[model samples]
Target: MKKFSLFGLKFMFEVKRSSKNDVELYSTSYALREKIIYLILIMFIIAFSSKIGLLSKNNNYSVGDVVISDIYAPKTIVFNDKSAKEKIIENMIAQSGKEYIYSADAGRIYLETFDEFFDDIYALKNNKDSNVDFKNLEKDTGRRIPDTMVKDLLSLKVPEIMKLQKETRKFLENLYESGIIQEKATIKYRSPFDKKIEKLSNLQRQVVETFAAPNYIYDEDKTKKAIEEKVSQINDQYIEIKAGTLVAKKGEILNERRIKILESCGVYSYKKSLGIMMANLTYLFIISTLFYQIIFNRYKKDILRKSTYRSTVLIIIAFFLTFRFINNDLIYLMPADTALFLLVLLTNTKYGLMMISFMLFFLLPIIDYDLIFLVMNIASMTFGAYLIKKVNTRAALIAVGIQMAVLKVATFGLLSFFSEVETFGAALKSGEIIVSGLVSGMIAIALLPYFEKTFNILTLFKLLELGDLSHPLLKKLSMEAPGTFHHSMMVATLSENAAAAVGANAVFARVASYYHDIGKCKRPQFYVENQQNGENPHNRVSPFMSNLIITSHTKDGAEMAKQYQIPREIRNIMYEHQGTTFLAYFYNKAKALDPTVTKEEFRYSGPKPRSKESAIIMLADSIEAAVRSLDEKTPRAIEEMLRKIINSKIEDNQLSEADLTFKEIEIIIHTFVKSLISIHHVRIKYPGQK
Candidate 1:
């Protein structure tokens, strides 16, 4: 006996002398499609992610360094008018009776008093210590400025300066919190004047305020003299606010060699953020492929077949592993949202949920997540996928759009719990969230058809369309050979149960059975069950002609299936069932006419049944016909008939070519024989009936 292993089953489809040229090309094309799509989708995902900051650009500078010069201005210094300053000054003067010295000359103010301000400002610069600028009060003011007064003044003015800075700092902080600012803001403030105002520190608020104002009135001669003398004395003094990008100088260039120590830190940070987004997006494509293939394999013929829980889990695992190679390219093509959409469209709710959680990580660089954030994204993606999995319209794509909104809210909510971001970041306003979601939904709707056609994903909706028995072939089967149609249905039930028991695809079994006997439609009256009048067309025909007609059904079925463009897997069962067995009745009659007749002439020329499902259908067809001839269907008689028939086939090696083993055959025979006997079992005879 010629024996082959599981791998050999695939080899039969290869281009060999035995296979049709068309079938070989078709098989090769299908294999190419699988490999090409996966590679293309993966590459697209990585490319897209790189475009969205999910991947970093290697540059000569780091975050605190200037990428471009003169792009940003120094922090501004705005002061309240004299009226506001005078009010505090007058209060200070009235509170303290100490004699106050004043300078009305603005030049003197710049030369003498401005020095103190500059000193204070300079004290703030290059400290890298505390953020405050004012230095030791006792030393600067010679004990005139009390510690309490300095503290109180700085407390008031520092807060005011911070408030003045509120807008600029707000943007910086927003960027930082959102992972936009890769580094903290570097700040500096400096001034050239320092000595003049240092004497006023010990004075009460009234004195300090009175003298601090530049607009105070005084004698004209005295003011002019003070201004001239001070202006001439100090020509070089100036104030400078030096706040901008901080870059490494010549001496710091040596740090480049040591960057490896911090490279992991940067990369880790990068991976945690954008890297995650990259990985997840890449993962999403992988997950989607696994889902599409797994479900495709199971339900390719049925159209409406769903993924099993175990298969779904396998898809998640396969994709997650694929995610390990994720780079910027994956993020560029398929973000978390797009990946989620594809998964939901191809597979089930649970799979979508699983994938969405994985996708959240894909956007990690852009949307840094903690535990809370992770949970929210997972929930949102899962919910979104669940919402649109069964939706058959553009409106359902809106549900996918809601996923983007869900992502925003989910991200926001999580951040609110764990981050200082109270609402959407300044970059992402409430309106923006709505718009993004709506846009995403539109994208999903737009891309769905392309993916379906390109990837050959036969969704449930497509399955529903195919399942309608009103299709031309099914209609012909019903109208022309109603008996065979009924037998096909019964065989479908048996085949589906058997396939399911052995972890095969039940939906494929059922659908394949429906179309299996389509060949009988050409000669409906010749087949026994379809002949309502019990008229035997074969009675007048020679045994050889009768054999020719009977054997033609297999060829006829295969030809019709090809015309219909049925999938190869389904068509395989059609061609292989009945397995070239002898047409016993016709062969015997022919043998009687010619004693030299050979049995080989009567046997079918077959590419024998290759799978368990096809082999079972062949057995069931023969058994169903044989059982009908019984006068009584007792358990003992049924068992004897089933065992004898199966054992004879076993001895004849009819089941040799298929994957089904002897043990499986025993179980199949026992199950089927029991089912048939139970259906036809007779009740005990009543005494008077005879």
Candidate 2:
């Protein structure tokens, strides 16, 4: 798990155990090969990913955004320029003059009305002694003559009154020639009428205000007729745009007018397609990197046995791809829950969850669902993944699947209630939807065996089955080689304890221990453990011959496991349990006879234990035999013997390729000592037994 950073990203790669030259180090080429394979897988996913959600014929265009490509008129289009036609009619109306009816009678009436008003003032002036009422005189005239004007006129002599009357007649004549706007009896204060009125003295100004009116009528019928004639002269203007004519160019900002034109030409487009594709590219890369960090780093084992990696890749791709075909009604049935359970069983719950977590990011786009469905699946998948972690039987798988089904339904219902999904009842009530969660457990059981067999993996169920003592291989060892069988059982117990203490594969260690010495069954009498008569076969043979016999057992055991169809890891354990260490008994026997005897002549040929399980079993095998051989059975003797044997294996470099750290090795040694002491502990003697 030690990591190094490159740029800003931290990459994870398992550091090598002890020596790079060790025969069992994972080959760099295999690592490279798997990376290439997974990269191709990522590329494949991205290539088809557009179908997942990307749209090439995208229409999410906006005005003012640059065009992606040149838009052309699909067909010839000829249409009227309505705005241009309206402009032409507006100008014609501006140039047309308004018709007005002139009134000569209006002039005479104005003069006579003022003359009468002046005569009233003179009568009031002459009748001052008779107490004449001026209020009555003002109302008789249809004018609001000011009191000053009336008072001035009343004070005027006959000559002044006649002169004011003449001036009023002149003002009326000017208005009659210029004409007033008499529409609604309101005055038109236009140029010519205002010129004469503005030059008036105070007295004449009063006369104009009281007497002036709209002498020029609007003449509505005449104006309406004139506008009709001007509009009739105008015609609809049109223009033709030919097909293939470039309406808009790439990189040009689209206006509303251009957008309408593109839509009419059937060519609206979005430039953001490239951006979407890039986002997808980044998405796939991050997930692939995460898979390498979480799954591959932890589970990368033998190059020859790559089923773990392949199966994970296969299952992930299959589950996400299936989302494409899952109907909305059956979305709850998406084997996401099932896929997750099987993945956890295939690898482990931890990495299985990580892979599924990445897979869920893409679920929304692939299924075209919102976060409600995504959250629902996450809740359901995580529940199923953890729920089935302890499942080891087909029935357990089914039971967990049933639990998952109920949880999926309940999760969907809650999500619907909170999110207010209107179709909750219809989607929930369907038998297919309700049972979707069960597929998590059901499909897992269905696929578990196939993956275990085809991929040569060890799921919990498979390991449990192998742990059964009644297995055919264990039974064969018991019948033909009882003593070796008993020794193997002790070794299995010791190996399991050591492995568990070091966090190695304890179950695999125990199961593999049962068959590690199966080759001894073929030559039961030659091996010390199986010789019930307590005979030493080495006494009957030359030391060289004895070395050959002892050394051949490892190779013979490996072949036996191969024939029994054991997994590659266990087969390796059978082969490597005996490292290339010199056989001291046979070598000493030969050296006593000849001083020149070489150490190589009595060594077992070994590739060495390469994995944690194999290495644990190797240590356990040596420690179990060494401790059991103690004549005094003392705790001090046992402890010293444990360190001696382990030191010898270390000196021989048997554990060099294994991933056991110094601390883990110490823990294994301690665990084996405790377990061995317990097993070999003396029982209390009965009082009368002797």
Best-performing candidate as measured by lDDT: 2
Clashes of each: 27, 5
Cα misplacement distance, residue 537 of candidate 2 (Å): 2.5
Could you give me the TM-score of model 2 versus the true structure?
Answer: 0.60
Model 1: lowest-lDDT 10 consecutive positions:
181-190
The models' CA-based lDDT, in order, is 0.55, 0.72
Candidate 2: regions farther than 4 A off: 1-305, 380-389, 399-411, 426-434, 593-595, 687-690
Tens digit per residue, CA lDDT, model 1, 1-690 = 344468546323334455457676577445445543553354345434443532444322333333332221122111123344445545544553322233334323323432454346335533444554434433343334344544543444555534423432343233222221011132111111123224323332222332232222324455456545544543221122122322223334323322322232222234445555556566556655664564345433322232322233333343444443443223212233555665666655554555455445543433222344455546666567667755666776776676557576656655554544323242343455556567666765566555554444545444444456887888889999999988887777667666766655556566778877888998988899898766899998999999988888888988887787655556677777777687778989998998898888887767678887787777776777677778888777777777887776767677889898777777777777667865687787878754
Give the per-residue lDDT of model 2 (tens digit) for 1-690.
778899999999886656555443467655645654573475347434634333444344568888777766644444345657788888878988877776656666756666666666677767854554446535654556677877766677878877777887777767667667766555676767677678887776786777665567778788888899778878765555666688788789987666656555434445554565566667666756665565445544422246766787677667756765544445655556777777788777876776677677755445433566677667766777787766657888778777766776777677766654445343643355456655666777788888888888877778777778897877888999898899999999999988888877778899889888887877878888777667877789998888888888888888877776776767777888887777898899899989898998888788788888888888888888777789877677888998998998999898999888889988987898899889998878878854
* lDDT (Cα, 0-100) at 690 in candidate 1: 44
TM-scores, all models, native as reference? 0.47, 0.60
How well does candidate 2 score on lDDT at residue 450? Answer: 89
